[model samples]
Structures are given as structure tokens and as C-alpha cells.
Target: MLRFFFVLAVVVPWTVGQPVDLEREIREAFNLGGFPSLAVAVVVGDDSPVMEVHGWADRAAGQRATRATQYRIGGLSKVFTATLLVQLRDEGRLGLDDPVSKFLPEGVKLPADPRGARYITLRHLATHSSGLPRNPVSRTERESDPWNGYSVQRLYEGLARTKLAFPTGASGRYSNLGVGLLGHALGRSLDMPFEDALRRKLLAPLGMSSTRIAMSPAQLKSVATPYARQDPSKIVRAWDYGCLAGCGGITSNLPDLRRFVSLNLRAGLSGVEPVRGASLTELHTPQRIWDGWSKATGLVWIVDHTRDAGDIVWHSGGSQGFASWLGFSPRWKIGVIVLTNCGRPVDDVGNRLLRQALKKYRKLSPKFRAMAERLVPHLVATPGDKVKGLFHEDFLKDVPFSVLKNVLSGLAKKHGACSRVLRVDPADRPELANVVFQFADLSLVTGKMGVSEGDPAKIVYLRFGR
Candidate 1:
């Protein structure tokens, strides 16, 4: 049996008088999007997450969705597989740089490039740079649910006949086959089934009792009935990812997902025995910068840069009839999980709720607000050289004035001139503030401005992007 420990809650100071009706917001979004069911959880700092559910889990059964209603999380399962691999590495049971073939069973065959099968490493698999295709070529007739018939034996047989998409580490592409293989390897290392290994290594220890590849009898009772697009009466059967469970098979509820989000936000602080603090740190660190660093891949998490949120690690998943999104910002101490039992995307809703949670909980310091008020307008209107003078020497050196000016000029042309400052709010960093600007076109643009702590604070950073 895996031993588990409870983490002591740490109180977080929230902003006073920030009125937000999260329940109403979720209901409105669900109604507008026409989703059969939706479940959302928002976590701020170390507090228990605020969870809300809207619509029906099973319309025919007259079941209403709740925080405990389970839904297939689809590709979000990749993150769990990646986390297990990192835990195995932390235990010295495996090395990320080790060849993936090292963990496969004897006689199992892998696809070979000109260089051979040994070219792909465990890191490449986790980061989706293993040069494997997204899915195996189907030998048997394809099932209504693609993954349902993909057996382990078929997986190996398909690999033998497959050709490499690219040389390992040469590029990054989303590959379900690569991540599934990683999960299979990790399971082999533990001498157990992939689902069993995940439970032992992560779910049990982290108190994620409702998360699993297969639902229990009690959990099945609460499982949401997924609906096809434009047809709420037609229910779709959940997929069975026989051998590719890591790619997209897990089912979970909002409460359980809230615990998972908490684990990420309080990674080092959560006293989960199976996961080490070092492992979580390593998992979130950028492993590869694909496409000139526009975005980065860290394990299975996508590292996104936002003007206000800084670095956010996130993943979105979709199966036959469900869509889910999970994201967290360690610097901001906030996390969000959004699950919908419909074919439509819910990532935007997840991101919007995360921002709302952060804004609701953050208290702005007067000094930071003052700095943003004075600096943002000046930087937008001033010449490149003059704007550079207002920045800290180190910041100016890293982000040249010309680059900054180009960015600002582009925003100005696209969004029109800034008409006024609507609000100045706190950011993840104490030195930074989120300034909401009303553009001449009546559009709102939120930007983060960093100010130094010196007597006359100079601008250190400015970012405005989704």
C-alpha cells in the first residue's frame, strides 16, 4: 500500500472587495457554449479550490453534474504519464537521457531510422520529439473509437513496420505514440501495468482518488454521458485506450482535479512521498525551445508566455465527446481545471477563469500601481531611445529599445491608441502590475509592467500578449 500524507494549508492574503460570481460565470459560459455538462475548479494560492458544475451529467438519466461527476480527460493523461516518468527518474530507477529501448521487454521491436532504434531517449518521448507518428497505422479495421482496439501486441508490431518521421531531437511534434510508449516503458520498469504503476506513484500519494484510466463501480455511477456535437440526445461511448492509455484514457472529477492542481502549485510543499520536489521542478523546466523559442515544451506540459501571467504550463485534452484543459502558474500560485462533456473546446474558458481567479485574489500595492500608471503610457508614446532611458540598465540591455518600440508600435496599430487606464492591479511578482487599458476602439488590453525597487523605480519589463 502506498503511504500518503496531508499537507498543512497555508493561508493566502486575498484582495479586499473583489466581487466575482464564479458560479454564475461558469453557468453562463456553459449555456452560451451549449455544452451538455461542464465542471470547473479554480485554485488561488494554497486554499482549497472553488469548484462549480453546470448542466447535466446524463440528461436521459436526469442526473445533474456536480464537483464529483467524472469525465474522460483525454490527452490530459499524457501529463500524468510524464509525471510518473519524472518520479521514476527521481528514485534513480531510470534516467531521462537513457535510451527508451533499455526499458522495453526482450524481443520487443522499435522502429529504426538510418542510425537505429537507440537514437530515441526517454527525454525525447516525454518532450514529444521522438520522431514517432501520432498514432500507429491500423492493421485491423478501425473502431468507432480509434484507441479501443489498439492492443499492446499491435503496438509493437506497428512500430516494427513504421518509419521515422524525423531524426530524434531534430524537431518537436505532438506524438501520442511516443508518450504511450513512455508510459509502457515506465510500467515495465515497475514490473506492473501502466494504470497500477500510476496509482502507486502518483494518484494514491497525491489524494487524487477519483482519477483513473478505468472507473470504479461507484465512480461509474457519477460518470458524465458525453454528447456528440449538435446532438445532445446521442450519447457517445467512452474510449478504451487498451495499450495507449497514456495518450488519452483517464477519467476524473473536479474535486480530484483540484487536488492534482494543488499538487502542481504546491509541488515542493505537498508532502507526497512518491514525488520528489526536485522531480516537479525538473518537469516544469523548459526541456526544448521549438520554433525559435516562440513556445517551449517541458515534459508533456506546454510552456506559454503571456503578458500578464508570465510562464504558464498547460495542456488540453479531447476524446470522443469530452474536452478538458489544465493549467497552472507556479509564480502566481494559481491553477485551473475545466472539463466539458461535449466535443467543443474549453481551453479558452479555463484560461479566462484562471485570470479571473488571480485578479480576484491579488491585492495591488500602491507603489506598483503608481509605477504602471506613469510608465505604460510613456513607453507607448515615447521614442525608442527615450523609452530605453526609463528602463533599468540590465533590462534595457536584455530587451533592446528597438525591439520594445516595434512591439508597442504593432500593438498601437492593431488596437488603436490607448484612450485611458481602466485599472492597475497586482501581478504574480510584487514588482510588476497589470494595467488594463481602454483602447480608442473601445477594446481592452491588459499589460504587465515591471518596475525596479530603487528610489525612483525604472521599468524592468513590459509584456502584452495572450
Candidate 2:
């Protein structure tokens, strides 16, 4: 069981007509997933991003999670590395079509492949089509942190023994080693460490103070305690990416990540100085098509075409004890970021919430509004038999008239009188019109009312608080 604490950092202004209860939605997700700690941030249009924090950062200490609590972002680090490479290209210091071998340090030879090394280009590496394996061969003793002992020398040695699983540039396959190599090459091109290059180029310009490959003492104190999936009592060690830090070593919190999502939503309009407009545009453009998944690949981002939301570029990542996801819809100008401390996957939670944000609400139909207006007053004024006549037969089978009266009376006492219909969802179910009600106390609640489509329609069902 997971305990939750609700914290809203910035409230999204009511722009799309109805009030979107993103906090309630996030709370439901946190409870359903049993996540020990989770942070969520949502940015809509040019408005400031809104953030919500739930669960415990340190369950034993009873420290509640907050927007500042850091969690490993897993493979989202690859996007940062990819962005750095694109910035270099914009500087005219490198070319995407150039052979990766051109940037390797002196005497560090690439492993031989049947398709030949020259066939693998910087573009192939960034796009995950470089024919490199997911991980380089290494003999690190720690199973939990396999990449911990992998050094630059071992990386080169592993490449010397690696074989291409597919032809170079033949198809898209996710390879951690490929992107790690790209990061290393980018560092070599700039004659600086990968972390320093990343900071100098992307992080500083975007004002992302909390996103980094390594944490300082203050950041370490604020990081959420990571837990195992099978046994929540057992805390897991954070995986050290070592030489492959480019693949998935970054740690970040909601506030910093919200800025990253906002930049992507604005598409270089956020004044990311190091990355030129052309390079940023090129980085997001689909470079390869993935037929099996029915998606495409940008630099390191996965391009998804959703039926309801249109095109959404996204990525999900998991480290040894944390899982994260971030995505944005350029078409919709909405972006979402979710980070959790438990190892269980939270990508679905993030995806569901993003879809929920994209849902449109409209004014309630006159029939539905009139029905609510009549029944609400009756239920609040007289208890049982007065409201019984308003309920559908199907609704009565589950909820007795007395029980329904008690529920409504309790709501009225706690939240005051129902004032107006805030919004309606007619598309969800043909028989039920899901309506939200704003109370005189300024709080909001939702209910579903079912009506028969007859000559004189009558109530068929009613449900609330879902």
C-alpha cells in the first residue's frame, strides 16, 4: 500500500472552458499503480507548466515527495546526448553523415563488423541503426550495476569484438552502445568530457538547474529512495552508467524536466542558444520509419501517431530502481513528464494522463442540465422517496433511494449547493452524459446520468464520483 500527499505547484488557468482536474487524475494513477513516490508535470500551450507530487520520497522517514525530489530519468539521457550532437553539427564541427571512426581517440579501434565500420555513420548511431549491440561486452562483477566498471578502454575493446546483428542503416533497432558511442564521439569532437559538453551546450542555456549526470551533496539529500519492484522493503542501489552514462545516467526532478518538455513543445523557440534552429528542426524530424511498431524515429525520440492526439514524440526509460517518461505533442502544444522511484514501469500511467489532457469538454446538453437541476435540488431538500422517482430502474437496482439521498446530502453539507454545470462528456458513453458540477463552495465534482432516447426520455442510470 502506498500513501499519497497532494501538492500542486502551479495551477493551470481555466482556458479550455472546463476545469481539468489533473491533480485528481494523478492521484488516481498513483493509487492504482501503488507507486511509492511519483512526480508529474504538465505544460499546456504558452502557459506556465503545472506540477503535482504524490506519495513518499522516503517512506520510512515519512518525507513527502515534492517537485524538487530527484529521480533517475533512465534513457531520457539519450535525448540530451542526441541534442548535444545536433548542436555540434550546427557548429560545423561535425556532420551526421560522417563516419563515427573519424572522431574516435587515437589508437582506439572500432570492432570489426561483416558490413564494415565505414558503413556506420554518426546518423546511424543517433538513429539506433548503427548495427551496434545494446550493450558492450564487459566483465563487471556487479550484476545490479553492470555498467559501473566499464571504462573507455573496455568500451573500445568491446567494440573490437562486437558483431553487427543487422546490416548497417538497414533498420531501426534500439542500441544503448550505439548512442553511448555517439556521446563519446561528441566529447572527442569538442575535446571535453561528455558531461561538461552537455552542460556547456544544453543545460545552462535552458536554465535547467536540477538536471545532471552527477548530483551534488544538496541534490543527493533530495533524491528519492529507490525501491525494488518485487519487494518494496528492499531498496536498490542506483546503477552507475560509467562510460555509458550517455545511454541512461541522468537524474532529474519535475521542475527541471518541465522546462525540457516546454522547450520541445515550443520547438527551439525557448532560445536554446547552442542548438541552431536548423539543427533543432533536423533533430526532431523523423529520420527512420519503424514498420513493426507503426512509429518513427527522430534523433533519439520515438515519433508516435495517435488517432486522437495526432503526432506525439516521446520516450520512456528505466534504471535499476526508477522509471520515467516524457513526451510532447507539437500539434496540441501539450507536454507531460512522469517520474517514479519504484522499478515497475510507469510509461502507461504517463501515456494515459497525456491522453486525458488532450480530451476536449463541451457544454452539457439542455436535457442533461435540466435533469441535474431537478434531481439535485430534490435530493438535497427531501431525503428518500422524493429523489427515487428521478432515478432509472437500472440505477436503483444497485443504489437504493435512501443510500443515494445520504450520499447527496453528505456532498451538499461538505461542498455546499451545486451551482452550475461546468462541462459534459457525451462521447464517452452513448447512454450516459458525464457532467461536472461546480459547487457554491467553488469545488467541483462529476457525475454520469443515463437517459433513454424515447419520445419522452426518462432516467435509465446514474453514477457519481468517478
Best by TM-score: 1
* Total clashing pairs in model 1: 0
Q: What is every candidate's alpha-carbon RMSD to the true fold?
A: 10.7, 14.0
After superposition, which runs of candidate 1 have C-alpha atoms over 4 Å from their true positions? 1-21, 115-118, 139-143, 216-218, 267-274, 363-424, 427-430, 433-466
Writing each residue's lDDT as its tens digit, candidate 2 over 1-466 gives: 1111111111122324556677788999898888898789887754544588999888898999998899998888899888888788878899989988898867766654565445688889999988777878663747577788458888888887787777787766899889988888898889987888888888888888888887778778888998897765568888887767888888888878877776676664645455665566667778998886568999999888765556678899887789999887766678788999988888898888887676632223577766776765653434557567765565666665567677777667767766776766653533456667667777766676766555455566566664
Clashes of 2: 2
User: What global local distance difference test value does model 1 have?
Assistant: 0.77
Tens digits of lDDT, candidate 1, 154-177: 888888888778877777789988
Tell me the lDDT of model 2 at 460.
65
RMSD of 2: 14.0
Model 2 TM-score? 0.71
CA shift of 281, model 1, Å:
2.5
